[model samples]
Target: MIALTCLCGQVRTELGKRPDFIHACNCTLCSKSGAHWGYFHPSEVCVEGDTKGYCRSDKEAPSAEIHFCEQCGSTTHFTLTADAVAKFGNVMMGVNMLLADERDLAGVEVRFPDGRAWPGAGEFTYVREARFIGEG
Candidate 1:
């Protein structure tokens, strides 16, 4: 199992299996979140601790909920659409690299997704070097 946690260790999550996809997004909201995006099956994840949800309004006045840690203001996960849970049985978890070890990130793909447009998202820039851990 893969474990994800906040810097202060107040929040923690246990991933049952490896993520289907892992990458970074350049969208306005994501750029400010300060963590890598990891898509996983929700049923396969177990979350602990209190996380504050920030819902972003869309054109229809609906909102996408972004989950962040209240203690450190760290973005740890989010769901852009309600159908996401039904379709993928998964949610996006912002893997806290700071608290993870290098071996924990092995075999994971790191890409830069263009958040300018999502759903039919654009291509990503492949990361040649692994920077998830050992950075702060």
Candidate 2:
């Protein structure tokens, strides 16, 4: 299992296993946060501690919900809204791999998603195969 925590360690999430895939998104919020995502099923994740949530929505894309440490303000994980959840199923969740332990990151591939110019404008791209821990 892999554990993801906030900078202050106030919030934590346990991933049942290494993610099937990891990717960096260039969407507005993602670009601002420089967040790289590791996808998992909600059943495969165990979240502990309290967190504050921020929900963002607009015309360009589906609304999203992000959860972060209440004290340190570090994003721990995110999920889709109700509409999106109905469409995609609540099995999917995205955890911030940037907060995971070093040993848990080995052999993980990092992909780049062209969410900046989403839809017809661009395509998903591969960024790298691995990341150095604490590089966040």
Candidate 3:
């Protein structure tokens, strides 16, 4: 398992397996938070410690509630909202892979999704070509 932790060690997330790929999105929320997201189901991992959850008020319907380490204010992960749960069910969650050591994720593909242009509809397009974590 791979463990990702917040700066103050107030939040810890365990990834049961290496993610196939991680997303570095260019949307407002992602860009501001500076998170590299690795998708997983709740059953696929474990989380410890208290976190403050924030749902964006700008969106008419926010899909996720982003969680951060209450003590250190480190962006930890995000959980789906009730409405999102109705749509995607409980099969999806996002872990902030940035909390993990980059060396621990070496060789994992990192995708740059053009979330800025994503109309909250269909598939995401690439902002740039994908690259592996340890690329020189």
TM-score of each: 0.70, 0.83, 0.97
Model 2 spans with C-alpha error above 4 angstroms: 60-63, 120-136
Best-to-worst order by lDDT is 3, 2, 1
lDDT at 3 for candidate 2?
Answer: 78
Q: What is the C-alpha RMSD of each candidate to the true structure, in Å?
A: 4.3, 3.4, 0.8
| Model 1 vs. true fold: TM | 0.70
- Model 3: which residue pairs collide? none
Q: lDDT by residue for model 2 over 1-136, one digit each (tens)?
A: 7877889988889987998767777778776665678888789999998888777655555556888889988888888878778877787888888888757887776677767666534555433344534365
Model 3 compared with the native: what TM-score? 0.97
lDDT per residue as tens, model 3, 97-128: 99998888999999999999999999999989
Candidate 1 residue lDDT tens string, 1-136: 8888877777888877765546666666667767666766556667788999876564443235677789987676765556555555445434544344557777666666666566444555443443433244
Considering TM-score, which of the candidate structures 1 and 3 is the better prediction for this target?
A: 3
| lDDT, candidate 2, at 44 | 90
